[model samples]
Target: MFTLFRKEINGYLSSLVAYITIGVFLLVMGLFLWVFPESSILDYGYATMEGLFNTAPYIFMFMIPALTMRTLSEEQKDGTFELLATRPLTDWQIVWGKYFACLLIVLLALLPTLIYYYAVYKLGATEGNIDTGAVIGSYIGLFLLGGAFVAIGLFASSVTKNQIIAFAIGVFLCFFTFIGFDSLSQLLSFRTIDSFIASLGINEHYQSVSRGVLDTRDLVYFLSFIGAFLVVTKTVLGGRKW
Candidate 1:
């Protein structure tokens, strides 16, 4: 598993995918947070990093699929998946190894965003005026959200040998999980049912954690979401034997 993990990371680095992924994420976020006049912090007249926390998930919706689309799909397309399957590693190991590698790249991209937090912290009307707890919670929520997207993308890749197809399907699935459920819930008139349905969506849980509450249910939801997709990916890989 560790070997596969290293190989996956090395493969991404070898092709400049890691650099591109991090660069694109930073570029987009930087434009919205600092460069643009309307959304820029300097124009907001407030020292909050709220824009970043709000915008990042949408950015991640696309960024994660772009990163993970080729993970298994390209290998399958090029017949390398067969070679990987023949290795001593189990399907779970292979899935997890790839999953972690993708997740690690996402975390690396996010690391530089901490500087935004530091800047906001210092630039506030009073030093340390920013809500540190909320910032931390939002960062955690963003990581888990990215992990969920990676798992979904891995599953999408496992189902097809075409990277483009994998990316499209992964993006659709991620979008549905992130917002579709919440949209559906809004159609219901009953408050109880509406809230329950909304709770099933990623946005609800993400918002909960982003508020700095650290609720265990939100954690479980993210873990289970990632686990469910990963299990499906493993099953797909296992079924390739037929």
Candidate 2:
């Protein structure tokens, strides 16, 4: 598992994928937090990073897809997936290895945002009375959200040898998981069922956990979502060998 993890990390870092994903994340965050007019951090009038958090999901939508699109698709395209399957590694190990590689890139991209935190801390009127709890919760929520998306993206990549198709499928799946439920709930016939439908979405749980309250249900939901998709991806890959 460790060997596979290291190989995936090295493969991503050695290529332009890691660099481009991180670069795009940083660039978009910078533009929204510093340069954008209506929603700029400076215009928000608060020392908190509400603006950053609000813009991060959209940035993540693109960045996570890019990070995950090529993981399995490239291996399949190069005919190395069969070689990987024949190795001593289990399917779970390969999935996790690739997952960790993408997660590492996401975490690395997030590290630079701490500078924004420090800046906001210094800019606070009372020597930084910022809501550290909320920020930490937001970070946790973001990580879980990324994990779930990466799982979905990996599943999509596992289904195809073409990275572009994988990317498209990933984007659609991610978008649906993120916002589709909420949209559908609005159109539901029964008001009583609306809440249940909306709660099925990633955004609903994400919003709940991002408010500095770590609900066990939300955490479980994300973990289960990721685990389900990963299990499906493993099953799909296993089918190839049979």
- The 0-to-1 C-alpha lDDT of every candidate, in the order given, reads 0.91, 0.88
Worst 10 residues of 2 by lDDT: 38-47
lDDT of 1 by residue, 1-242 (tens): 99999999999889889999899999999888998786798898877777888889889889999999999989988988888888899988999899999999999999998888888888888888877899899999999999999999999988988899999999999999999999999999999999999999999999999999999999999999999999999988888863
Query: Taking the tens digit of each residue's C-alpha lDDT, what string does model 2 give over 106-171?
Result: 899999989988988988777787999999999999889988998998999999989999989999
Could you tell me the lDDT of residue 17 within candidate 1?
Answer: 90
Model 1 pairs in collision: none
- Where model 1 places Cα greater than 4 Å from the true spot, the runs are none
What does the lDDT read for residue 104 in candidate 1?
95
